[model samples]
Target: MRVTRPMLAVAGAAVAAAALAGCGSGGDAAAKVPPTATGSLESLAAEVKCKPNIQTDADTIRQAICTSSAGKFVLATFSTDRGQREWINEAKDYGGFYLVGRKWVAVGDDGVVTALRGTLGGDVEIGTDHHAHTGHTG
Candidate 1:
């Protein structure tokens, strides 16, 4: 068999595509936590250098109050993506900031959330204004 320029080009393109696919998370490396960070609420908290005061422990969610140098915040790990989304949706009405990971979420004020993002490697989601609920009777 004789090698050709076209065959070499095709092989190179396939290799490049495979390499990009290995990234898995849309190639956004900053949006993923380290391997050890997803094990539990405690481990995730540890990544942000917090001591968790666990508040809710259930089959669906585990939550804690954590105070790191960044400040105090709520740390929670969920059993499923749907559960996390539901909880975040409800919590957002209270008006706060969220640092979200695979199955975990951290709730705090803007500064705290910003600080947590540095160590946690997740996306920041802003909550709706709590004051919006004041005038509504229903």
Candidate 2:
């Protein structure tokens, strides 16, 4: 039996759709929980009275916030501490900033507020203060 190109494309699309449906159904029931509402990073920084100095290696922080019983709803992750700090400093320079649950949050950069994943829980207040000196300034 020979399959035409169109037939193969249709079959592939059908399989992809089925796989996506299965995966969606397999999601955890707990994932439905809404993220926490930690105030903006800017507010946290102002409370501390220091510009954030975030680190470049902040995976530990992301895990802390992502798994916390109190703030697990946010689901943030930081590939690097430098990335996290860059967001904070950008927020300070701009304005609009808000925390999503505990893990990930958003801050204004350039002309838009962007969400960043894998953030440290404790560093939320300090923003990037702890990581600023570790040479992660990008």
Candidate 3:
């Protein structure tokens, strides 16, 4: 069977078109935890202090900071006015943070939160937007 140059070109174009179509339709398909699956406010408070970032702090302080003036953090599904859906951490006491995919953010008493953002890559690795180090304690 002999394939002509024109036939090969047409085949290549079709393959390209199919690839583009797949790319265009590709949206984040990961199953997000529903907002309604949240447990008790106290349980959510306990979970927050256990997180790596705030774990080192005293449990009392953690609870105060997380549940007191801060508020209870609940896992909930959220949608913007524009209808973009996201899994968010809705802080009931003090404002909390959210994890949209792997990105994380923390809200403080001032109601301002800092997000640790990253760039999505074809590889499974993510590059953080910032870095931090702790000073040695003598």
lDDT of model number 2: 0.40
Clashing pairs in 3: 35-76, 35-77, 70-93, 70-94, 71-93, 71-94, 72-93
As a whole number from 0 to 100, the lDDT of residue 78 in candidate 1 is 98
Most lDDT-accurate candidate: 1
- List model 2 lDDT by residue over 1-138, tens digit each: 256888999999999999888778744432433333354444433332334444333543432222122222222344445665555566544333444334345332311212222222232232333444567657
Backbone clash count, each prediction separately: 0, 24, 7
Q: What lDDT tens digits, residue by residue, belong to model 3 across residues 57-120? A: 3311222233333333222222232221221222322223343322222233222121121111
The prediction achieving the highest TM-score against the true structure is 1
Report the lDDT of model 3 for residue 12. 96
The residue-level lDDT of candidate 3 at 85 comes to 22
Query: Which stretches of candidate 1 lie above 4 Å from their native place?
Result: 1-37, 131-138
- What's each prediction's TM-score? 0.68, 0.22, 0.20
Point out the worst 10-residue segment of candidate 3 by lDDT: 114-123
**Runs in model 3 with CA error above 4 Å?**
1-3, 27-138
Give Cα distance to truth, residue 29, candidate 3, Å: 3.2
Instruction: List per-prediction Cα lDDT, in the order shown.
Output: 0.85, 0.40, 0.31
